[model samples]
Target: MSFREKMLWVAFIAMIGGFGFYFLTLLTPIGQNASPDYYLGLLFFIIGLTIGSMLVATLILFIRNRSEVTFKEDERDRNIHKAATQIAYYPLLLGVWGSGALFHNGVSTSIMLNILLAVLVGAESIRLGYQIFLYRQA
Candidate 1:
């Protein structure tokens, strides 16, 4: 697999792991009042997954293709990246606006924050996957 493809795969896996951690933590019973440690642990899990995946991806790329480190993306790759980014941006913007509307309609802050994070992760994953597809097509 190409470096970019490998990076995308790592990112996708990290996102899935992050979501799994989030759901597992959320489903855990904590009686009446939940401790702040649960939330902190969730945040730490996500951060660790993201950083670890990125570090592994970088190491793999450097080890496998160190000579190609200075390579520049070609026109097709650039086009695919741009199109994917554009598609991703629309959902992100819509999500932000929708969150604002929800808040205006009296949604709770915690709900809004969760919605925003979900939207952001979903959009970014879609963009990365779409770009990888385009790269394969080219």
Candidate 2:
């Protein structure tokens, strides 16, 4: 598989793993009563896992195929990225708007943070999914 395709697989796996962690965390009473810091920490943890996964995948791909490693993007790549991002945006916007409404109604910061986290992760997962789909469309 190509490097980008491998990275997409890594991202998708990390996203699923993060969600699993989130759900597992939510099973605890402490998680049920989330503080803003708790959500932020979770967000950081999820992001760290995702970026770390991509970085490790990149390193492995580079080592495995040093001469084949490429950092080039052509029109198809650009178009796929743009289209995926646009496809991901609407849900993210809606999530943010929902968070805004909740905040206006005096909802807790933790809740808002969770909403934002969900939006960020969900959007990223969709973007990556779209990219993978496009890559496999050949």
TM-score to true structure, per model: 0.82, 0.83
- Location of the lowest summed lDDT over 10 successive residues in candidate 2: 108-117
Which prediction has the highest TM-score against the true structure?
2
Residue 124 lDDT, candidate 2, scale 0-100: 85
Off by over 4 Å in 1: 27-37
For residues 28-99, what per-residue lDDT tens digits would candidate 1 score against the true structure? 685114555656566677778778877887887779877676668878768988999998999999999988
The segments of candidate 2 whose C-alpha lies over 4 angstroms from its true place after superposition are 27-30, 34-43
Enumerate residue pairs that collide in model 2: none
lDDT of each: 0.76, 0.80
